[model samples]
Target: MPEPERKSKITASRKLLLKSLMLAKAKEEWDQEIVDKQAEKERYLSERVTPLHTSGLSLSQLQDLCRELHEKVEIVDEERYDIEAKCNHNTREERPVEVGDWRKNVEAMSGMEGRKKMFDAAKSPTGQ
Candidate 1:
C-alpha cells in the first residue's frame, strides 16, 4: 500500500507486458518464416518435376553441359592469347607527330566542333 511498493508493482506489470508483446511478435515472425520456406520448397519441387520450356535436360545433364562449355571457353581464350602474342611480334610502323605543327593541325581540324557545340548547349538557359 506504500507509494514505492505501488510504483514497483506498476513497473513489474509494464515489464511483463513488454516481454509478452516481444514474444508474440517473435512467434509471428517465426510462423511467417516457416510458411515462406514451405512455399519455396513446394515451388522447387514443382519445378524439378515439371518439364522445362527449354531443353528438357535433367539437373545433372545441365551441370555436365555447363562444365564442358566452360572448358571450351578456356581453350578459346588460350588460343586467343597465342594469336595475340604472334600479332604483337609483327608491329606496324606509326607516323610520329611534329610538336611544332601540332597546334596548327588541331585548329585546322573540324572534329572539335561537335564538342564545342555540346559545351555551348550545356550552358545555363539563364546565362548565369
Candidate 2:
C-alpha cells in the first residue's frame, strides 16, 4: 500500500454554524412571543375600555359639540389698542408726535361742521 488516510476529530466551522443557526431560531421565537403578547394586550384594552359603547354620544356627536363650543368661544369681539412703543434705539429725541385728543376728532367727524369743528383746525405730524 502507498499510505493510510487521516481524519480530524472536530470541525470548528461546523460548530460555529450550528451555534449561529440556534441563535437565529431563538431570536425568531422571541419576536413571535412579543407579537403575541401585544395582540393579547390590544384585545384586552378593546374589551375593557371601549368608550364608543359606554358613552351615550358617538364620536361624531362629540366632535360636533367640540366644534360648537369653539365657535361660541370665538364669537366675542375684542377691542384691541397698541399704546406701547418698543425699539432697540438709544437716542436723545425731544418728544414723540401726539394727537391733541380723540374727543376732538369725534366732534369733527360729527354733523357739527364749520367753526364748531375743534379737530378741523388742529394740525399734527406723522408717526413718532
> How many residue pairs clash per model?
0, 0
Q: Which regions of candidate 2 fall more than 4 Å away from where they truly are?
A: 1-9, 53-128
TM-score of each: 0.32, 0.35
In model 1, where is the ten-residue run with the lowest total lDDT? 90-99
Tens digits of per-residue lDDT for model 2, 13-73: 9889989999999999999999999999999998976454327888898898788767755
The lDDT of each candidate is 0.78, 0.68
Q: Please give the lDDT score for candidate 1.
A: 0.78
**Highest TM-score against the true fold, candidate:** 2
